[model samples]
Target: MKEQTLPIIDTDVHHSPDKKEVLAHMPKALAARGLALPGGNGFGNPHGVNRRDATPPGGGEACSDPAYTLEHHFVPNQIRYGILHPAGLLAAGVSADYRYAAALCSAYNDYMLESWLSFDPRYVGAILVAPNWPEAAAREIRRLGGRPEFREIIMTSASESPLGREQYWPIYEAACEMGLPVAVHPGAEGNGISNRPYAGMPSSYFEWHTSLSQNYMGQIASLAIEGVFNQFPELKFVAIEGGIAWLPHLLWRLDKNWKALRELTPWLTEPPSELIRRHVRLTTQPIEEPEKPEHLLQIFDMIHAEETLMFSSDYPHWDGDDPRFVLPRKLDEAARKRIFYDNAAELYGLPPQESTVSEEAANSATPTN
Candidate 1:
């Protein structure tokens, strides 16, 4: 019997809006207050932001041009639906002025709807909400959360404090009330705005990237300890671009400590590991590639990949994974179906859509990372 094919539903495709497009959405008054759009923000990324070759033929940054992106990724990869994780704009989460940050997020969402979602039915927008001001963020979610294109609330993973704090609970409450999942994608670390590592900033980019799991670990632990899962049982979180290998270690430590320290926090109704498995979902980009396939499989087993893992391409980034080969070869057809399509489809409540890309069209366009 022939193996079954699945329609790819990518959860973590990044798209940076053209500066002009973002500016068009920004109010002239707010634009003057340093609502820096996309590439205009002065923060330097030493390795540059995207894959150099991904620049659209129309003359803009990678993932900026929706038409080129469709030709390069969605068509070739047969991605029927994608969650647009807006790049660069998420730094608003750590902005100095809460009002300015909120405005920037609103502008970014408008830009996404105009420049990306309106262009294709396959694309969905993330409502960028600055968590620094929880009430404002909640207001934004209330305003736009009901839209069909704006399906999820996107916030930067890097923040002044752990996301589980009561101050941030309003954002999650709004998300739950609106019936959307909260996606916390990774961003720059050690930049003086985000939560810092226990040891302080790493000396090199390689060290910084390698230690990103620390950020996720800290946030997840905070959520568990603060009883976020207990407070909002229906809420779901998607952690994108953070590798999954550290999950097992974090879970093990959380359970071990909870057993001895259960009295300190009486709110936890279940083990932290169990809560994570039930409430959290992780993306598989920058997957923990081990020397041996067995080692990778071991990591998956420990984390219960089938229950939590979802497919993410991180498209147009230098380290983006391709849907065609991101999964380990050892995964059976059922696991592949769950990761690449079913998990995300169910999580986002996306309706099944027929594949519109023909084999000839998919083959005619070359694939880009």
Candidate 2:
């Protein structure tokens, strides 16, 4: 690829790692308590360390090689999806053991702010945090907010407490104060968040993928049902890598539940959908596969949320699709401009356009007559 072939602000590129880069930052005392990462700890989640964990490479070896970076996967495909990644992938990639999932996550945010975001500010990040360890997570958020490039916080759905519980309040409060959105994508962690239910039902990748956002749905609904959202009005939550097709349904179910159970939570002042409509937005990537009939675009319109759908390319993943292929056929020019470009621009504080002109876009589209 050459200078022009940049991806659209792909909010889901997989790695920007530095193992020793972060392990070294921790004091010997803390480092000793934990093993470094990129090994067994982070096994098979979406952004698992190294493309294939069975064949793990050191941070330097992994990131130095094109196969492990966004450029290798995205550039050749002729897609203009700029990379976005959870800070945890970097932490796990940089450390040999998972001991410092939280710390390495912090270090990677620093590296990204100083490096990747500067690699081009249009480049954005989803800094990882462990909500189970709210104080630790809060510390990282405060540290990261100081940097302009580290725009949001990323966490696994696997928190120690259910998201609706008050225990996670610090995480919510810190995010609200920092003026950053929390990017919650469903993925794995040794303990932070888990998709597996270990129930009687047999599980498949599709099953887990569907449930990923369910975890958030639980949290958000709980937060609203339990009145957490009422207290933290400023919080803006972004769902990563998940398509929004299921959201309208989730909102409908939530609204129905509130009508049935509103009396249980005395503190809540407004309807559940109002909270959802105001504070949450979702990325429109891996967009439920086929872009269908014209009415598909109006699904959110029914819920009064046409503007909340942002776009993301789950970059570097084998299944991550090209933006040209993902964009809906009926998406108006304005919606296309936002989903393909502007929504993310506003979300991550990116400029209207970057210096790179998306050579991939230029090459892929035939010249207009």
Candidate 3:
């Protein structure tokens, strides 16, 4: 029997927008000043971060040209939908000037809506919010959240404090009101005004990248223990580009600690792990490769992956995963379908694809030996 093709909803497709274009949308005073977004940690990738071949034929940065990206990435990969997370401005959430950060975010969103999301129906937008200014971020969410193209709210994982703090609650409130999930992507860690890793800053991009998941672990634990989910039951969060191997371990430790110290927080009526399972979803990219592939599958089961894991290509980045070979072949078709399409479709409230519906029906009707 020929293998069936599954629909893909890539949750982390990145596009690098030109700064001038983004600035064009900003207030004339800021645009005239030519302010740039905050820079990343000095630990640089000596060989660079983007794939060489991903550059557009028209001579722009990789993933910068919407048409080229659609032709090269979406068509070739058979991606039914690609969530656009603008690359360069992800660090705006960490800027010291909260007002400036908020303005930059608004400009970037306008640029994205005009340049990328409008270029194709397949492209979906994630509303960029400045976490430092919760009110401003909330305003931005309220401004753009009702749009059909915009499906999720995004902020950088790098921050002065854990995301669950009361300061960030307004953003969550707006997201819930808009029926959108909040997503945290790592790009500003140890950069600008954001706090460094708990273990202190790493010396190289390699070291920094390896420890990226630490921020996610901290954020997820904070959200659960602080009762963020309890306050906004409708809110959902996507931790983009953070590897999944650490999830099972983090939840295990969280559950054990909660059991021993239930008195510390009276509001938590259930285990931290249960709260995390219900509110958090993660993308699979830069997926952990254990010595035995089966070990990865075991991790998936521990985390209830079918309900929590979503597929992300992190496209055009040097370390991006190819949907074709990212998952283990041993994964059953049902699980594969959920990760590849269903989980994201449900999370983003995307309509069911006709192809996917027909494919499911065909599979169910086939006779088995």
Candidate 4:
């Protein structure tokens, strides 16, 4: 019998273009404000840098041209690396030109459907939406409903409205109705200006990247305690680009608070941890370093229950870990099967993998670390 090749899907893969590429289709009035147009360059992330010093073992030159790379090199590289479902760029914050932001976002989403995800049945995409305007976001969600290529809805973790608030419920409800997963991807410092936190982490970029996940954890935990998931049981949430080790800590703290405030928020029928177990999913990307494979297993064993962790490559980000190098080494065959492919395929509703990664499998099939 022939062995099954693991069909992997990377969920948190981000495809945000530098300002210039994002404004490519803005309107005349809005295009003028887009960086792609003349004299339109004001936004930049203050804390972002590619100190990677080099690419992940097998990752090629996707960084040089992500917008075009996904169309050519990206998917082929993912396929060669044993990854099948490569979700790229569709979820990026493309509304940089605020005036025509919605139009720009629609064009980008359409492009994802036609240009990238449409390029291959195995590739999936997350539709980018601005939480700042819930009504407009709802419209986009409705627009893309049931599109096979667009299975997840991606948005920034930071928003004008607290994620737990009712103002965002319409967008949440729309996604649930459509059976799409709502995913939060953390953006950089210029992604939004924060009065707090950034003040202390001035010197280190790692400080911000690590803290970014915690910020989303805080918001998602707040929503869980606030009964967001309870109200929308069909709605699945994904907290992406953060490592999974923090899950136990965040869940422990959330459970602790709920114990005291059960009366305050009666809608929470179960503990915060239970809610996460049910409707929430977290992505593994930009991993923290560990000394050995056992070291990683110990971490996942405590914080994530195999299926809870999804595969992600912060593709094209200078420091984005090569999926091939960062994933296969840390997990055993069963664990790798799910994190690297199974869970992601299930998340995006794609075809399943034929085999799992074994101890010696990395040498033969070349699983992403």
Find the candidate with the highest lDDT and give its number: 3
* Deviation from native of the Cα of residue 2 in model 3, angstroms: 12
For model 3, the superposed segments whose C-alpha errors exceed 4 Å read 1-4, 355-369
What is the Cα-based TM-score of model 1?
Answer: 0.91
Which ranking of candidates, highest lDDT first?
3, 1, 4, 2
Question: How far off is residue 76 in model 1, in Å?
Answer: 1.1
* Per-residue lDDT of model 3, residues 1-369, tens digit only: 333267788999888888998888888977886766678566688888889888999898899887778677776666778899987788888888787789999998898777777776677899999898999999999999999989999899999889889989999999999999999999899878888785998888888889999999999988998899999999899999999999988988988999999999889999888889989999999799999999999988998889999999988898998888888889998999899998999999886655433332222322111
Displacement of residue 41 (Cα, Å) in model 2 is: 11
Report the number of backbone clashes for model 3. 0
Best-fitting candidate, measured by TM-score? Answer: 3
Residue-wise C-alpha lDDT for candidate 1, range 1-369, written one tens digit per residue: 323256788898888776556766777887875544222223435887689877888777788877788787877677777899876778788776777778878877777766677776678788999888999999999999999988889998888888899999999999999999999987655543666664686666666767788899899899888999899999999888889998989999999999999999999867899999998999999898788988988888898788799888899888898776678888887888778887888888886434444555433433321
Question: Each model's TM-score, in the order given?
Answer: 0.91, 0.76, 0.94, 0.77
> What is the C-alpha lDDT profile of model 2 across 76-183, one tens digit per residue?
443343545643453242233334666666666665565556553334566677664677788788877766657778876554456768777888888888888877
Candidate 3 residue pairs in backbone clash = none
Candidate 4 runs further than 4 Å off: 1-5, 16-24, 36-99, 189-204, 291-295, 328-330, 354-369
Each prediction's whole-model lDDT (CA):
0.80, 0.59, 0.86, 0.61
Worst lDDT run of 10 residues, candidate 1, spans 35-44
* Candidate 4 lDDT by residue in tens digits, 1-369: 333244456665444333434455555666565433111124334644432422334453333333344433344334322122222332233334333546666666765564545443434577777665678888999999778768888776665445878988988999988888888766533333321333343444555655766576667776787688888988888887767777778888889988998999888868888888878887777676776667667768766647788766666465665556666454678887777777767766665555433324323322122
> Ten residues in a row with the worst lDDT in model 2?
360-369
- RMSD in angstroms, all models? 3.8, 6.4, 5.4, 6.6
